[model samples]
Target: MDAAVSLLRRAEAAIPSGRGASALFAMLRPDDDPQSWRSTLNNDGAPYQIAVTDAGADASVRLIVDPFRLGRDEADRVGRNLAAFDRIAHRCSSAAAARCRRFMAALAPSFEEGCERRSGDIWLAALPGAAGVGIYVTARGRAPQIQCTRLIAAAGLDHHRAAIAAIHAYGAVEAYSIQGSRCDDLAINIYWKPRGGTPLPPAINFEPPALSPGSPPTALARAPLGAMTLCSTFAVLGSGRGSKIDLCNHCLGLDLAASLEILGRFCDLSPAFVRGAGDMLAGEDAEIAFLGVRVRPSGDRAYLYLKPAASACQSVPHLVEGATCR
Candidate 1:
C-alpha cells in the first residue's frame, strides 16, 4: 500500500486529474478493493502498474475499475463514472481531443439508448496514467458494427471506415482511451475461440500487422493463445492510426506458473515480483480469478491482469468456429 501510494504521488505531476477514473489510483490504496486491478508489465510486474509516457512525461496506468467491486450498485457507480467522463470530455477544446472524446462518449453503455451492454460489458481504465480515462465497450454481434460506424462518423474517423470494417471475430472490444480529452485513434480488440484445447496461432485466417511479435497464441510455445478463459487477440487496421496491429491476450487460467512463464516472454520483469503483486491480493477463500497477462503491440509490452475477486460477468460462451462450408 505504501509503495503504490508513493508511486502514485511521484507520478501525480505527470498524471492527469479530474475524471472518475482519476480517483482509481487513490481509491486503490486506502479504500481500494483489490478485486479490481491489473499491472501493465512495462517495468516491474507489480499488481499496480505505473509507466512514464513515451510522447511526454505523463505517468500512465493501464487498469480496469469495476464499479461493482467497490460495494456500490452498478448503476449508481457507472452513472457517476459516465457523467464524470462527459464533464471531463466537455472541456476538451482541441479538434483531435473533441473528436475522439465524442467518439468515446458515444460508446458509453445506455441500455435505454440501445447500447448493447451487459452488466460486465462496460469497463474503465487509466491509459498508462494519463489525465483522462479509457472507456472499454464490448459488443456481442454485428449490430454494434453499425453503431461503431455511426460513432466513426461522429468522431471524424470516417476515412478509416474500411480499416475498422476489416476486423472480424466472434466478439470485439472497442476501447477509446481519453486522456483528459486528448485522444488519438480507436483500438478495436478482436478475438476468436476454439472448441477445445489451446487455439493455434494460424487457425484464424489473416496476416499479422507489420512490426508485430508474430502471433500471440503461438508467441509462447507453452501457453498458446486460446479463448479458453478471459483471452482474445485484437485486430486493428492501420487505416485510422496509419497501420499498426497489436497481438494481446487478456486471460485467466487455472494455473499460475504457466501464466507467469507466458508473461516473462514479453518483458524482463522478475517473475517473483510479478507473482508477488498478484499474491498481495490472494486470500485463502478469495477467488483469485484476477490472474492473467496482457500484451501490447508496441514492443510487445506485457501486463499482469488481476482482479482479486470475480464479478458477475457472464462467461463468454466458448466459441466453436464452425467448419467453413468450402
Candidate 2:
C-alpha cells in the first residue's frame, strides 16, 4: 500500500463511527488516491485543491492549499478540520499518524465554498511543526470572512493584529448630491481648462446622477470629473453639512478614486492601520472645492494633499511623508 494511503486507513480506524463521524470519513475511502483525494461531501460549487508532505524532523507535516474551488463556508470548515487534526495528530502513535495523514492529505476542495461565498480568491500554505504551525494566506477581491480567533491562531496573534491595523489605516470616502428630483446620488461630469486662453467648456453642466446614498459605492463614484454642479440645498440641509463640503461632482469623483486606489495599495503592503481610518471630505456648499476625505496609510506614515484649484495646479499629489502617493 502507498504510505500515504496506509496512513489514512489507520487514522480512519481510530475515529468512532457515530454522531456525524461517518459523514466525516465518508469523503475518504480505501480506493481513494491519497494524492488526489479531496473532501467534497459538502461541496457547494467552489473549487479547492490541497497537497500534503512529510517535512521530516523539524516539521512533522506540510500542507499546501489552493482554495479556489470551495465556497467560503466550506473552506472555513476545512480549515477548522485541519486545526482539529493538528491537535489530534500530535498525540497519535506511529500507526495512527499514518491514518491521520490522509485526513488532511489533499483535501483542499473544502475551501471552494469560501471562494464562491465571498466572490474572492484564496491561497493558503501551512507547515505543522513540533512547536506550532506556520501558515501563509493570500486573498484578493473581498476580504476573508473567517472568525478572528481562527485567524489569530492560524496566522499568529501578532500578524493578525498587524493585518487589522493596516485595514484601519486605509479608510473610505464618499461624495454625492441631491438636485432637482434626484435624491442623494452619484454624479459624473467632465471639466476642461482653456488651452492657450481659448474658450473652455461650460463652467457647470449638470449630469444625471449615477448612484444613491443607500447604494453600494463604486470606484468611479469615489472620483468625479468634468463640469460640476453642487446643489446648495443638499449641502446646507444635509446632516453632514458642517463635516462635508461641496465640490464639482466630476472633480470630487476623480480625487476620491485616486485617494482610494493609493490607500488600497498602501494597505496591501502594510496592514498596520486596518481599523482606525474613516471617511473624510474637503469641498462644501455650491463651491467647487475639496470634499470630505478619509486619512489612510495611518499614523505619520502617509498623507494626502489638495491644493486650491489654480491655473497652475495641473495634478493632485498624494504623498507618504517624504514619498509621493503615486
Candidate 3:
C-alpha cells in the first residue's frame, strides 16, 4: 500500500496542473473491490466524488488519472468508460497486445473529452505477472493523441522506458516504439491520432532470416518519405503470417463503415481482412501481417495470407516468401 501511494504521488507530482484540473486514483487487490485511494491536489479544492466504482477479478491493481474537473453528467460517463477499461485490462492480461488495443479503440468514445485546456484521462493496470497495459490521451494542437502500450516490468518504472517516453512526449511526438526486453521477444507499440483522424499505426520492421528483435505483431513499416506517427501498440508473439481485427468499427459514435475503412488504411490491408479478423486474433502465436504490404504466405486460406493491397507499400522485404506459411 505504501508503495502504491509513492507511485501515485510521483505520477501526480510529475503531471502538469492547471486551475480547474484534477486527478483520481483507484487501486484493487486480487478479488478485492476497487477503492478511492489517493488524489492529486485539486486546483479549486472542489470536493471530490467517486468517479469509477467498478473493478474486475483479473485486474489486481488499477490507477486512473482524470486531469480535468468533471460535471455530474461527465463524471457518470467517465465512470462507465472506466468500466470498459476494467474489462480490457482483464482481457488483455493473457491475450495478444493487438487484441487489447482493439478493445481500447472500440471504447474511444467513452473516454473523457479533450478541449483546448485539458486532455483526456489516463488509465493503467498491472496484472500479477510482469505484464501490464496503459492508455493515455492527449489534447495537443487541433488533434488529440491516444497511445497504448503493453508493459513488461523488470523491476520498477526504470524498466518501462516507453511509458516514460510517452509521458514526456505527451504533447510532442505522434508515436514511437520501445524495446521491452532484449532476451524475450517483447516490444511496445505506440500509435498517434489527430483528434478525429483515424488511428495512426505503429511501425513494423521485419528483417530477413531473423525478424527485427522486439517487433510488434501488427504494425505498419515507417516510410522514409512520409513519417507516420504511432497511435497505439499491442503485444504480439511469433513470426508466421497472422490475422488482424479492428474493434473501432464495432464501437459507437463513429460510422462503422468509415472506422473499418480507416483501420484498413492504417495497416494497408483491405476492409474484408479487418472485418474477417475481428476477435479472431485474440489467440496466442497469431502472426499478423498485411499480405502484399508485409508478408504473403503461399496459400488460399484467409488465415494463411492477410488481404493483399496493390497500392499497399511493401514495408519490408519478405525473406521466405511464404515458405513458412501454415
- Candidate 3 global TM-score: 0.26
Q: With candidate 2 superimposed using the best TM-score fit, by how many Å does residue 77's alpha carbon deviate from the native? A: 4.1
If scored against the real structure, what TM-score would every candidate get? 0.50, 0.20, 0.26
Task: List residue ranges in candidate 3 displaced over 4 A.
Answer: 1-77, 87-90, 93-136, 139-157, 160-171, 175-188, 192-227, 230-326
Better of 2 and 3 by lDDT: 3
lDDT of 3 by residue, 1-326 (tens): 22223333322232222111122333321111112211111111111111110111111122323323232355564554455455435524344444434433433333234222232333333322334445443222322222222122311123444443443344233323222222134334433322233332222222112133454223233222122222333343432222222121111222323333333343333333443333222222122221212222432111111111212212211211222111
Of candidates 3 and 1, the better by lDDT: 1
Ten contiguous residues with the weakest lDDT in model 1: 317-326
| Candidate with the larger TM-score of 1 and 2 | 1
Candidate 2 at 118: error in angstroms? 12
Candidate that would win on lDDT: 1
Error of 3 at 4 (Å): 44
RMSD of each: 10.3, 24.3, 19.5
Q: Return the top candidate by TM-score.
A: 1
